[model samples]
Target: MPIAITGPNGLLGREVAKVFKKEYDVIELPHDILDITDLNQVREVLSNHMPTVLVNCAAYTAVDKAEEEPKKANLVNGLGVRNLALACRDLSIDLVHISTDYVFNGNTDTPWRIFDVRDPINAYGYSKYLGERYLETVNPKYFLVRTSWLFGIGGPNFVSTILRTATKQTELRVVNDQFGCPTYALDLACFLFKLVKTGAYGVYHVTNQGITNWYDFAKEILRQAGINIPVVAVSSDEYVRPAKRPKNSALDPFPLKETVGSLPPFWQDALSRFLSETQTKECLD
Candidate 1:
């Protein structure tokens, strides 16, 4: 049986498709190609391919924008996932859904555990939580992987944002209050490929190790890219947004150590690898 991946053009999905295709016959499904929100489309596509595993990297990830358009977010993240779950169940295909650490309220200081009660403080998180609920209840064979602060080559991410911003400005102000671990998309993809093959069938927290807030993360990105500039760390209150971010949404690696045998490399190491791969000179221009 072969593996199929949704959102093959996305940051994580691109890597997931690349990783799986190296080992198994892979089907690539982008949003335009397969709209998960439409039940008829999902069922028809799945039925036609009949892939053994379906990795859902597609989601409505507009954090602040979701506040204004909660319905759009829910339609894609919540009801859309429900449609995929229902189809996967009928087709007997294993579903692997990508989630965010924002699912937690971010009230606690420590790392959020696997089974921590989900209390999303933002619309985006709540939408993803809805998807999780649908996936858990609807499908027996499912992998719910919650990750955070993703940075990769294909997508517009924080790393790219900081790099692009630094070129125009001498000093950068970043929020220091919120905290979470950064995850390399390729690393996450490799792990997911290994995970589905295991048939663990449960929740897992996957991210590069270590915790840091936005300000510090930005500083590290510049440092890695050999960019020298003044980075001023500011509190969340100083740099407010439309959505409310968790104070500390760091996820704890529980059974990842047991199931995957090890966690992904540290955030700094992953950042170094990303820098090495990316065109730092072009980012500055």
Candidate 2:
């Protein structure tokens, strides 16, 4: 059976299409072709395709800007997910929705469990939380995989930003107060595919193992590129954005490991592969 991947041109969706195509028939329906926010469009397009699985990668991910344009974010993130959930329910299709750690309130120190009390502090977080609630309510057979700090070849990411900044400036300041596990889009794509096969329908934390703050993550990215740059560790207060970020973005993958029988390698290993695959000598050197 063919699989329909929404937002197929996105950072994670591109990887998902590439990986899943090797195993299953894949149909790429980006926003131009299938608007998840439009319920009529969603139903018309998905019914025409009739894929067995629908992996929703569509999202409005402008975090800081989300504060100013919350309605746009909620419409895309919350209403869009709801539309898909309804369509999947009608079509008898399995849904794998890409979620974020932002759904958490940035309060917990330990990795958030599946049933943690969600308290979203910022607009973006609140919007994602709404999406999660809508999806779970509308569909019982769905896999909500939450990942964070993703980087890959398909789009601009934190890793690319850091490397690009290092070329023009010797000293880079990054926030050390915020912590998370950086995920390679490909690794996460593979894990999602694995989940699709297992039919393990529930919420699961999916990120590359281990954690680091922004400053250390920048350091590691520079080290992998063989670039020497002075990284300044600044507090979150020192560099404020329009949106409030999670001080604790790290996720526990114990549920994923127990269900799938294995987990992706540490984020460092993923970063090394990303650099080798995407970075040219001009970018690294």
Best model number under lDDT: 1
Q: How many residue pairs clash (N, CA or C atoms closer than 3 angstroms) in each of the candidate models, in the order given?
A: 0, 0
Off by over 4 Å in 2: 280-285
In candidate 2, how many clashes are counted?
0
* Candidate 1 per-residue lDDT over residues 1-285, each given as its tens digit: 688888899888888988998889999988888999999999999999999999999988889999999999999999999999999999999999999999999999899999999999999999999999999989889999999999998898999999999999989999999999999998999899889878899999999999999999999999988899999989888998999999999999898979978889999999998887787745776
Give the clashing residue pairs of candidate 2, or none: none
Query: Model 2, range 151-262, lDDT digits (tens) per residue?
Result: 9887879999998899999799999999889999999999999999999899999999998899999999999899998999999999999999989988888689888889
Local distance difference test scores for all models? 0.93, 0.92
User: Which runs in model 1 stand beyond 4 Å of their true positions?
Assistant: 280-285
